[model samples]
Target chain A: MTKKVLVLPGDGIGPEIVGQATRVLDALIENHGLDVTYESALVGGSSYDAHETPLTDEVLAQAKDADAILLGAVGGPKWEQYDISVRPEKALLKLRSELELFGNLRPAILYKQLADASSLKPELVSDLDVLIVRELTGGIYFGQPRGIRTLENGERQGYNTYVYSESEVERIAHVAFKAAMLRDKRVCSVDKANVLEATELWREVMDRVSKEYPEVELTHMYVDNAAMQLVRAPKQFDVMVTGNMFGDILSDCAAMLTGSIGMLPSASLDANGKGMYEPIHGSAPDIAGQNKANPLATILSVSMLLRHSFGEAELADKIDQAVSTVLDQGLRTADIHTDGDKLVSTTEMGDAVLAALA
Target chain B: MTKKVLVLPGDGIGPEIVGQATRVLDALIENHGLDVTYESALVGGSSYDAHETPLTDEVLAQAKDADAILLGAVGGPKWEQYDISVRPEKALLKLRSELELFGNLRPAILYKQLADASSLKPELVSDLDVLIVRELTGGIYFGQPRGIRTLENGERQGYNTYVYSESEVERIAHVAFKAAMLRDKRVCSVDKANVLEATELWREVMDRVSKEYPEVELTHMYVDNAAMQLVRAPKQFDVMVTGNMFGDILSDCAAMLTGSIGMLPSASLDANGKGMYEPIHGSAPDIAGQNKANPLATILSVSMLLRHSFGEAELADKIDQAVSTVLDQGLRTADIHTDGDKLVSTTEMGDAVLAALA
Candidate 1:
């Protein structure tokens, strides 16, 4: 019996890049003898177009039963006119919350081949690889008692609560330490412990949780200093764990350091390791159907889907190596292209990566 | 009547840098015929060492009485062992809260001469000069009911309040718009309105306040996106305004864009225009008496002190021009030095700027 993988080629450049990714998935199943079966489904704007909802119950059911999900980018200017409640982006939020995908893993890895593309000096980012494990289900984003109201003095006041429970922090800490165990064996938990008492609880929980993973070293940093250090020396970080809001800022900051924003893949996982993989870059509507979209990120998402959901780390390593080998051979997509690199169409680049995989 | 300017040389490199700044201050009083009177005081570690309190009543009284205050860098590793309440950093928070210094202005300026020093390409930051107006006295940092507590289930929880009143937002908005009027006439107000309802009120207040200064264009950005934009294209901004926590992060991110962290100055202002101007950088305990610490930031603080507090815009322009002239002449402080640039001692750098002023 084969495991089921639900493929959601979402919107704009979604179909183009994800189509290329599926080709690689097929090759793995046929040639590498991977025991996986895939199912394609409508999601995001397409699902909205067909069913008047961004995520239909039928699609949601299929997704719930699948072993893993591989989503391409979603949303574009075309859907900007829709109500926020029914917008295409609501699908992603819905998927995460419904699936209980609490840990969002964003890896900022600077391939040596794309070193010159970074904003920092090549020496600072050439070997950069940092994983940011963001607790997505809780924190200020979902904290209650948040709204604008009239005060006793007749002055209007805007207020929100930043709260974190011990269990919430502990679970995310376990995810981070588990990730670090596979890489550098170091996890730095970032929070505003000195200021935000919510994060003070987060820090305490992180320390308590680390006791369970003695192999992984844990360090702490204030959120503000963490932002500075990302700009100053991003490579110094191995794995950084933080709450939703801080992680959103720091992870994006870390992603830009790689200069391959279009090539980075991310994973959102549940406690049991059931996950959703996707490229960090958005659906580039302008370049849709042009065969100019970079497909490696989507292809890498397939690799992450394999390793994280199916526990096939060796298969994922092969895909990563194949992408690197193609880059080393000087094949370039328009986005990551520099002078003297061979410019290739999306299909051509995808083919080269597949050939290298073989 | 002379405007009383209080000079507080705080700790570590404070005295060395402040001494050079006073040379420029003396030149303005004598050569430029500026009607200014000066007084000296101790603060931070020096005050803690002398009075056992980081800020004394006598010094606070002098600060309140002075028309303007110019401060050098404060705090050092030597005072790291002090109790949290008496720590040197406590002096800053006390001063801001006591004086009701609600507005903090941090200017991130990238000189044409040192453009290569930036992590970004020279084209991105070459002409960058953004003033970040931070609301210092309000928001999460000072909000009430922030601490760890036990839940009904005996699990620990931590929490903080992020609250802002209309008046707090209005005053900072005015400071930003007014500052923009003096620059490129554009203000981008950053908030986390979409998720954090507190910022929804902030957005409302910013828009309401913008009506008062229609000449200064106002735009809005979510805090997370603003962080990305600061790195992506910092030059696109003229002035930015935000609350205490967001400002603390964005302002520091903007400062690093210039790669001149040692050469930036900041001013914290009260409602009446009485202000505390200081370098954005901290004291380097390692080079306290060696005269190796950069004094340009301190000198620049003198300029801000003149303009913001004394309304001596012409004298302030002169100081800015003098500093730029020295940089163009290839005179370098130890921190901002590159190959072929003349590495001048702190005093030499100050003297050259004064010579340029003449």
Candidate 2:
């Protein structure tokens, strides 16, 4: 049976970037003995214009039926005037909730060829490879009874409840430990347990789950100390797992350590290994249709999709090596262009990666 | 009339470091003709040993009566086995709560003389000076309904309320704006407003407060993006204000950007501007009584104490310039000593600052 992949080329440079990623995927199927089938659908602004909704039920059904997702980018200034309920960005939240995608994985890997791209000294981040596993569907972000209320004294009080059940924490901890088993077998669970009781339970649940993964070493750190550790010495960590809020902050800090989001990829996964892969950046609306947007991040998303959803680690390695080889060839896109390197167009860089793969 | 200053040199190197700070203060009183009186009190581990409490009632009363408070450091490995209620660290919390020190000010200033000490490239962090204004004594850390309880289904649930009143947000915004007026007149209020309603109200209150300070440029950023920008381009910010949890994380990240915590000072102020000043470092028990601890951070705390509590900007400038001159004179302590720099002990470093003042 051919493995199914659903592609959502949303808006702005989404179509162009996703177009190159598809070509790379096509090359993998054609040259390598791989069995795969993919279908593309419209979403975000384009779908809102064509079908009167950012995400159609028909498209969501296809996504649910597929084994994996390949997403380019979503939302642009054109949809800024739309109501929040029908906005292009709402489609993502709807998909995430509907799919029960509770685990978000973001890997910050700096290729030696682009070592100079990191804000940190090359010695610190040159060989950096750390994966952040964030609990997505739960935590304070989606907790209930969150709003501003008028007090008895006529003063306004704003509140959000941060609650995590044992099961919620357990499942995410399992994801972290399982992820660590695939990597260096070290998992650093970040929490604010020293202060916040919500995360105190989170640490407990993580400890309970760690008993099953005897092969994996687990450690706990305060969130503030974890943030400091990321900047001071990023290479010391292999895999870091946390709640939604902390993951949102630390993952971004880790990405910035690389100094360029143009070449990064991310994954959001459900319990059954079905996942959505996208770049760690937004659609470059200003440069839409100009072929100036970086496609490496999108292409790297393909690498993540294979490894995570399809369990095709070798194929993922092939794609990652292809990207590295092209970077080594000094083929730069406009976004990541530096002096003394040959700057290429979005399509030209994709072509270089395809040639390197061949 | 003489202003009374209360000193609590808590534990380990606290006595030694604060001892040097007092000599510098004494010189200022004698030579500059400033009228100030100070009395020492035992706190932290020593108080726990003496009175079986980290802070005695008499010390608390004196702290309340004093114009400003100077704390050296607190807690050590020896007190690690103490009960949480009687722990030496609890004294600081009790003081913060009792004194109502809601505003926490952390300044990350990369001294030109010690710029190379930073983990970041010297050029990026050379002139870095940004003050983080954190609203202490509130938010999730101290909010109600915080604990772990078993659910009806026998699963445990942990929760904490993240809450802020209009008055609380408004006051802290005022503090941020006023601090900016003293500096470059720019304030970046960080929040998770896009998700959490508590921070949405915080942003709303900040906007309401911004109208009062026409001279200060107030900008709002999501906390995650702010974290990234700190690593990417920290110098772009002047004064950053946020709630307790965020401030705890960002302040530490900012301090690490300076690379050496020994030269950093912190201040916690109440609504009336009476404050507690201290170094942003722990009492190193291992290095205690050896005279190897750096006194710069405690001395710098005196600078913050003079400016915020005493409203004596010129005296603060004198203390700060004396510190800069001492660093310029190539004096160094074990923590921040580099090659070709004169290695000085805690007392010698203090004496060098006194000579610079003369």
Candidate 3:
């Protein structure tokens, strides 16, 4: 079966990085015989410039028809003057909600070659691999009845609701357990059950869901302790699943643990295993077209797209190996370049990965 | 005029550590001529054992009347079977609400002597000092309309309101700025204003309050970015203020960056500067009576009590200097004792600090 991929090269350094990622995909198609056909479309600031909306109805319909979507970052200072509803970032929220992409997979992998870049002792973070499964499109970020209101005493108060349904918890839990099965077969659910009743229910749902995955060893941790443990001994965790807000905080913390955010990729998946893959790094507007942006994260997003959306794990492993081989060759992009390493431009780095893959 | 101090040695290692702290206080009162009188009480499991309640009315009255309170620690497995309403930890919550102690001050300080203990590189955390001022009495943890309910569709939904009034944010903001005035005069307010309306009001209040403390430089950061910044370069921050939940997570993360949990102290203050001070580490039931637990955090709590509650900065500095001198002399407790350091028991560590003070 030929899987369809939608590539949305967004604003800032998006076009340059996505160009490299697509080049890698082209090689996989021509040389490796990967069965995939991809089409390009404009979204975010680029789309706004073309159609006056961050995401067009046509582009959205195309996204729905695709097996996987690859996004090359979005939003920039140039689009800041636009109204919030039509902003470049709005396209992302619209896609997430429209597609019901509730499962967000963020992997924080510290390659041994770049361990010295971390503020942590090299021994603590070298070769560290942890996947955080976050329940997106739900929780406090989108809960309703949220706004500022005036009280009877003439004081202003603001409030937002943090809510989760049984089905929501169930689906996200399945995503986490299935992800754990593919890796370490251990999933630690993070919540604040001790204080918040909402998370008390979250913990209960997690326990109920754990009974279904007998092989996966499940544990629970308070959010505060989880934060400390991430800093103290990140290696102890294999998979961590949590609500949207906690996931937002912990995943970012875990990414920083690697100290190479430029090399991190993420995927947002729906119930049907269809996903949107992208680099965790934002579009660097400062160095937009200078060919200096790191494209490894975006390229890895292609690996995620293949492995998760297209069910091509072998191809994904090959892409990962090529990345490791490039690093072993002492090739470095500007963001990750240290002393005595060969600093390569965006195109050169992408070329090295393709050559290694070949 | 003599100031009254109430000491609550709650449970587990609490008694042993508080005993050591009182010994230092005796030195301060007798040798240093500190004009403060102290009394003792029981709380937590010990209190439940004696009075069938975690907090007695008489003790609560004493706490209310006291100029300051120093709590050692609380809770152990011995009281785990008790009802949630009568749990040992409830005593602390009762005191916090009753005393209106809405300002929680948690300091993460990595002394140069203990730099090797941190997971971060020595330069990143050596001599690192950051104070986290948390809004204690309000936010999602204590919000209204929170519970699990059956939806019309027969699915169970759990919800919690994350809320903050203008006055709540204002008071906490003042606490942060005032504390900043005493330190580096830089206050970074952490919130998710871009998403959470509750924190949006929080940011607005913080901005409004910043005008009164013109000497204190105030900035805003999203909670996710704050977590990352704490891991990447913790020293860049001087004082961080946030609502209860973010503070709970970020403060613990910052404390772990020092890699010495047994050496951190905390304080909870009210609008009037009256406060309760304690060690951030919990009661270690396994080492409760072994004389192996560390007393430095509790002793440091007394130092915080003197500075924040008693306004005795000179006396607090003296106590801090003594603790530093003892560490310089190569004394260590079981929790923080590395190879080649002279291992000291609870009482021995106390004697060393006293000797350093003398």
Candidate scoring better on lDDT of 2 and 3: 3
Fnat for model 2 comes to 0.88
Off by over 4 Å in 3: none
Instruction: Give the whole-model CA lDDT for all candidates, comma-separated.
Output: 0.90, 0.92, 0.95
Q: Taking the tens digit of each residue's C-alpha lDDT, what string does model 3 give over A1-358?
A: 8999999999999999999999999999999999889999999999999999999999999999999999999988999999999999999999999999999999999889999999999999999989999999899998988999999999999999999999999999999998898889999999999888889899999999999999999999999999999999999999999999999999999999999999999999999899999999998899999999999999999998998888888999999999999999999999999999999999999999999999
Off by over 4 Å in 1: none
Task: Name every residue pair that clashes in candidate 3.
Answer: none
- Local lDDT at A214 for model 1: 91
Instruction: Name the best candidate (by lDDT).
Output: 3
Q: Residue by residue across B178-211, what tens digits does model 1's lDDT show?
A: 7887789999999988899889999998999999
Lowest-sum lDDT 10-residue window in model 2 chain B: B118-127
lDDT of 3 by residue, B311-330 (tens): 88899999999999999999
DockQ of each: 0.70, 0.90, 0.93
Those runs of model 2 whose alpha carbons end farther than 4 Å from true positions after fitting are none
The candidates, ranked best first by DockQ, are 3, 2, 1
